[model samples]
Target chain A: MTDVPSYLSPTGQEIVFLLLGVVAVGAALLVVTTRQLVHAALWLVVCLGALAGCYLVLTAEFVAWVQVLIYVGAVVVLLLFGIMLTRAPIGRAADLDSRNRPVAAVVATATAIVLVTVVIDGFRTAYAPLEPGGGSAREIGSSVFRTWVLPFEVLSVLLLAALVGAIVLSRTDIRGRR
Target chain B: MHVVYPAVVSALLFSIGVYGVLARRNTILVLMSVELMLNAVNLNLVVFDVWLRDRLHSGQVLTLFVIVIAAAEVGLGLAIILALYRNRATVDLDRLRALAEFPVPSPEDADDHLPENATEETAGQASRASAATGPTRPPGRDDTPEATP
Candidate 1:
């Protein structure tokens, strides 16, 4: 068996994360700017896919896979189906403009600045280099099954409720007494 | 390795998604924008979880829950859009202005707002234009009518 490295060096990992981050951000911008609904969906897939890559680079392999399986694969497909079903005009709709673009921009920019400041300040005092070999799937699995059991069970119930809610909403004949 | 990379990326993604949600008029495109935002959050969670090196893998668990929730959201959202389309015959947001009022209208009354001519010509033109630019096939032009409703 190949020996696992004691630790991952911060430099290489940082570079990889930066690159993925750039890709994710750029794709997200495209998702917003694109006028066509289908084009927007396709760009969304790219953005989400790059995010999954970022997760992998962060050593959270299971989360990365879940991102791919759920966001890129399932959510996007459902959005496409919704587009087709609604027959939303494929071209740009005339009402895209909001009267409050300037206000929204200011708010968003302020939020970004504040968040950045908070994050940088929070991490200023402590710096922990990436630890190797701790985020393996087996370790994650055991922890979930053992210590996090209650939350896991609660999540399952949440999923069930969501499923039932979806079915009820989609049913055509809601008033059976007709 | 620092979590900053993923954090920054997720933040940017979330910002763009916010712009899309605020700017786009089409309901479908709006839904896509929401997906972008969710993905941004997922990236952040996974990165931080990895950085912390906690045994619980809370980030992965959270990501899983987000996925399930997103799926259900899209399903229900689509159903609502479909019901609206059946009644109004158009999904243009500008035309849905009255939706804000919560004013109830009979389905037959809703038909008055529909474009008078649901012509194949305009739909064909739209589809052709979209085919050149958009990712999926256009809505009304499906030759396979017997397929899923």
Candidate 2:
């Protein structure tokens, strides 16, 4: 029930994926553990960029670009604004960490082990060959509108709600002074 | 070469995110950690979308939805954090225990390192609040005003 992938050797793609994976994982590790707030944000950008590269290697071109646009371009820049607004310590600082690090490490490691084991066991030998035009924008758009209409619309509503909630929460009325 | 590579990498990213959330004291850093976790989930979705070879590309669609939702969450989360900082001065999670039965003084207070702007803004709010309440109004905290983690 299987055929060899003729497009290119899997090794090339695999190596690229591994490279991107290492970059993404290493940067993500920094994102959490960095004491400098701005450096943490920048590291998050690197992690996101590497994930986008992974998506490209997997042949999900649209998703990869969207990953860059939404994550590296938008979300991280927004996070930087948050840091500025809150006046987070710009450089390294010891107060950045809490005292529960040992507990955190345990929980995180346990979760990673469980998830990795499940994934490896479940998808051990499955392979899906990529065909050209598989992840074209037209294809994704048509499917998104036709099959996933409800969810797409619901997300639009959710975004609107979040927008309103944020504005309401942050309102500071000098008029209340009078 | 194994499909497991992407999966394992995603897992590592998610684990790091968990550690960030649990161990970081700053609110913005916590938000950044949440983003890391979300990105890990996106990686898994795309990897599987290609692996399953589904006709409709449901995995990628779902990833799109997730990205949009993550954006919405960050927008709202940052707004709330900004508001908290404006009111309380410091964005330290341990110090922002307003809901505790015995509220602890913020770390800024213990160290007497309250930012000058925080003090000024709070004083201005207090002065304005008091004038608005007037002598006839009790100095009690009303539901109209409140403050955050």
Candidate 3:
């Protein structure tokens, strides 16, 4: 903390990160505030992709790729499928927002103010010099296999359970035992 | 890179998610907002991991775990939403109030409230009566092909 870099001179990496962060935040705002149902999902793709770029700028290379693959690739598609299957209106409808928008806006604004203040106060001088290869697949894989194998295996089991649960819930033929 | 950049971005994203979850009427939209919130947490994890440079890399590993869990959650949630749409014929969260408790009518006003309660009760009773007649059938079987056709 004593030898922290001053905020007056930001490195190239910080500049790139802030740019990507702006894109992500803007797209995320569009995702929530968009009136069209399908358009919201598309905006979400933009938001997630920008976040992936942010991760790359942060030097978490492996996490960035995974974020792109899992979130931008699979999750957005799943959400689109959900929107279509539910027969959501194709064009903008007026009632997408509920009556609680004003209250929600107030709460969200308060949350943002408090969180931003706390984080800025706590980490004002926490500068991390970016180092390449620290977040590569080789490093993360070795760390995961060596130190985090138990949780990895448990997560696989959880994924399998969720898969089975989804199938059971969606299928009409699978009746529970009374 | 200053840690506050990612931290502040994540905080704002989370607040947007909170707003979407509170304001959206559609169940699927609510799910999207939840994903935003989860992504915000993931960003926080990755940033902290990079900052600390831990030997175990717990932050990145946990971010991976959170991603996997988020995938599972979206799958299950969409299934539940599909089930809800199938049963209720609409996915509007505000209208899905079957389990909401309605105030019981006081005896003094029972006479005037008869019409309103009658309408509500008959809808409940009709559904109940149908269930009573089909004791051998499985409950919530409306999606069955034979039942549909």
A95: Cα error in model 3, Å: 1.5
* Span of ten consecutive residues with least summed lDDT in model 3 chain B: B140-149
Across A45-113, the per-residue lDDT of candidate 1 in tens digits comes to 887787888777766776677778877888888888888777666776544545455665666666667
TM-score of chain B of 1: 0.66
Backbone collision tally, model 1? 1
Model 3: CAPRI class? medium
Give the TM-score of each candidate: 0.75, 0.83, 0.89
User: Per-model C-alpha lDDT, please?
Assistant: 0.66, 0.80, 0.85
Candidate 1 residue A56 C-alpha distance from true site, Å: 0.6
**lDDT value for candidate 2?**
0.80
Cα lDDT of model 2 by residue, B1-149, tens digit:
45678888988888899999998989888898888888888888887888787898999999999999999999999988876676666788866655632233455664654434454345346546666656454333231243322
Best candidate (score: DockQ): 3
Q: Write the residue-wise lDDT of candidate 2 on A1-178 in tens digits.
A: 1753432555777889899999999998888887788999899989898898888888888888998999888899999999887766767787888778889999999998998899879766766555557777898999999999999999999999999988877776522332
Q: What is the iRMSD in Å for candidate 2?
A: 2.6
Q: Is the docking of candidate 1 incorrect, acceptable, medium or high quality?
A: acceptable
The ten-residue window of minimal lDDT in model 1 chain B covers B140-149
